[model samples]
Target: MDKKHIKALRKIVGEDNVYDDKAHMIAYSYDATRTRYEPDAVVFPRHEEDVSAILRYCNDNHIVITPRGAGSGFTGGALPANGGIVLGFEKHMNKILEIDMDNMVAVVQPGVINMDLQKAAEAVGLFYPPDPAGQDYTPLGGNVAENAGGMRASKYGITKDYVMALRAVLPNGDLIRAGKKTIKDVAGYNIAGILVASEGTLAVITEMTLKLISKPKL
Candidate 1:
C-alpha cells in the first residue's frame, strides 16, 4: 500500500491504530509457525465497522488480508501466506452482546475471549461449550475461522457446532450476515456453515452470533 492508502486507512481508524514499523511488522510477520512471511503492515481495528472498512479497502486495492487473533494458532493460521495485510481483530469484536436466558443463548462478538464467554455462561447457569486448548486468550473469531476442534469435539463438538450466525466481510467488500438467532432454520445455501471453517480465506469475520445452551444440572 502507498502512503495515500495508508493515510486513508489511518483516517478510517487512526494513526495509532495502524502499525507499519519495521520491528512491529517483523514481529507480526511470523506466527507460531516459525516460518517467515511479512506483510506490508498490520491494522488493529477497534470496532466491527473498522474491520469491514479495512477489509473493503484491502480487497478493493487487491491487497491480501489475513484475519488473525491471539496468535496462539499452532498451524501458522496467522501467518500471512502471501504478504498483504494482517487484520488483527482482537481490539474490536470483543463484546458479549446479550444473554437470552429464556432461549438459553448468548450473543457475542468474534474478538470475545473463549474462556471469558465460558465463565460468563456458567455464571448465568448456562454453558458455552466449545472449549479449545487456548481457552484463555483464543479469540472466538479465530476459533470460528479455524472451525477449531478440541477434546470435546468428539462429544460436545467443535466451535462451529455452537456458532449460529456471523457478520463477516467477503473478499468483495460487502458486510454480510449468515445464520440466525432462531433455534432452527433451513433458509438458504448455508453460507454460515461454509464460512465456519474457511480459515479467513473466503472472507474476514467482524462479528459472530453463536448458539448457547443452559448448563445441565448434575
Candidate 2:
C-alpha cells in the first residue's frame, strides 16, 4: 500500500491499530497451515463501525480485505493470500455483548473465543453445544465460518445450527443484519444460512446472536 493509503487507514482505526512493518506483517502472514502469504498491512477494527469504514475505504481503493479471528483454523481462511489488508478482530472487538437468559441467546462479537462462551453458558445452566477441538483457542466467528463441529455435534449439531442472527459488513461496506433472535421470527430469505461456512467470502461478520440450550444432566 502507498503512504496515502496507509495514512487513510490509520485515520480510520488509529495509528496503534494499523500495522505495516515487517514484524507485524510476518506475524499475521500465516495460520495453522503454516503457509505464508504476507498482507500489505494488518488492521484491527475496534467496533462494527470501524469495520464498515475500513471496508468502504478498501473497496474504493480496490484493496483486498481478509477478515480474521484467532488464526486457529486448520484451513487457510484467515490468510491474506491476495495481499492487501488482514482485518484482525481479536484485538479489541472480542466482546461478549450480552447473555439473555430469557431468550437463551448470547450476543457476541466475532472475536469471542468458543470455549469462553461455552463456559459462560454452562455457568448459567445453559449450553452452547458446538465444540470444535480448537474450542479452547478458536474464535466462535471462525467456527461459524468453517461450520465447525466436534464430539457433541453428533447429538447437539454444529455451529450453523446454533447461529440465530448476524450483523455483517458486505464487500462494498454496507452493514446488514440477517435473521432474528427469536426462533419464531423466521420470515425472510435464509441470509444467515448463506453466510454460514462462507469463510468471509460473502461478508465480514461482526456480531452474532447464538442459540443456547438447557444444560443436559450427566
Candidate 3:
C-alpha cells in the first residue's frame, strides 16, 4: 500500500489501531501453522463500522485483506498469504453481546473467545456444543470460519450446526446479514453455510448468533 492508502487506513481505525512496524506485522504474519508471511499492515477494528470503512478503502484500492481471529487454527486460515492487510479482530471486538437464555442463543462479536462462550452458557445451565481442541484459546469467529468440530461432534455437531445467523462485510465493503434467529427457517439460500469454512476468502464476519442447548447431565 502507498503512504496515502496507509494514511487513509489510519484515519479509519486511528493511528494506534493500525500498525505497520515490522514487529507488529511479524506478530500477525502466521497462524497456528507456524508458516509466516508478513502483511503490509495490520488493523484492529473496534466495530462493524470500522471494518466496513477499512474494507471499502481496501476494495477501492484493490488491496488484499485477510480477516484474522485468535491465530489458533491448525490450518493457515489466518495467515496473510498474499501480503496486503491483516484485519485482526481479537483486541477490540471480543465481546459476548447477549446471552439470550429464553431463546437458547448467544449474540456475539466475531472476536469472542470460544471457551468463554461455553463457560457463559454453562453458567446458565446451557451449552454451546462445538468444542474444537483449541477452544480454550480459539475465537468463535475462527471456529465458524473453519466449521470446526470436536470430540463431541459425533453426538452433537460442528460449528455450522450451532450457527443461526451471521453478519459479514463483503470484500467490496457491503454489509450483509444471512440466516435468521428462528430455529427453523428455509426462507432462502443457505448463505451462512457457504460462508462457514470459507477461510476468510469471501467475507469478514462481524457478528454471529449461535444456538445453545440445555447442558447434558453428567
Candidate 2 displacement at residue 30 in angstroms: 1.1
- Poorest lDDT segment (10 consecutive residues) of candidate 2: 67-76
Which residue pairs collide in model 2, if any?
Answer: none
Q: Candidate 1, residues 1-218: lDDT per residue as tens digits?
A: 57787788899989888887788778788766677788878888888778778877876788888778877787787888788778876666688888788877778877889999888888988888888888888989888988887777786888878888788887877888888888787888888899987888887887777777768685
Show where candidate 2 strays beyond 4 Å: none
Residue-by-residue lDDT tens digits, candidate 2, 73-178: 7789989999999998888989999999999999999899999999999999999999998899899889888899999999999999999999999988999999
Shift in Å, residue 81, candidate 3: 1.2
lDDT of 3 by residue, 156-185 (tens): 989999999999999888999999988997
Q: Which residue pairs show backbone clashes in model 3?
A: none
* lDDT values for all models: 0.81, 0.93, 0.92
Whole-structure CA lDDT of model 2? 0.93
As a whole number from 0 to 100, the lDDT of residue 15 in candidate 2 is: 91
Tell me the spans in candidate 3 whose CA falls farther than 4 Å from its real position: none
> For model 2, what is the alpha-carbon lDDT of residue 212?
94
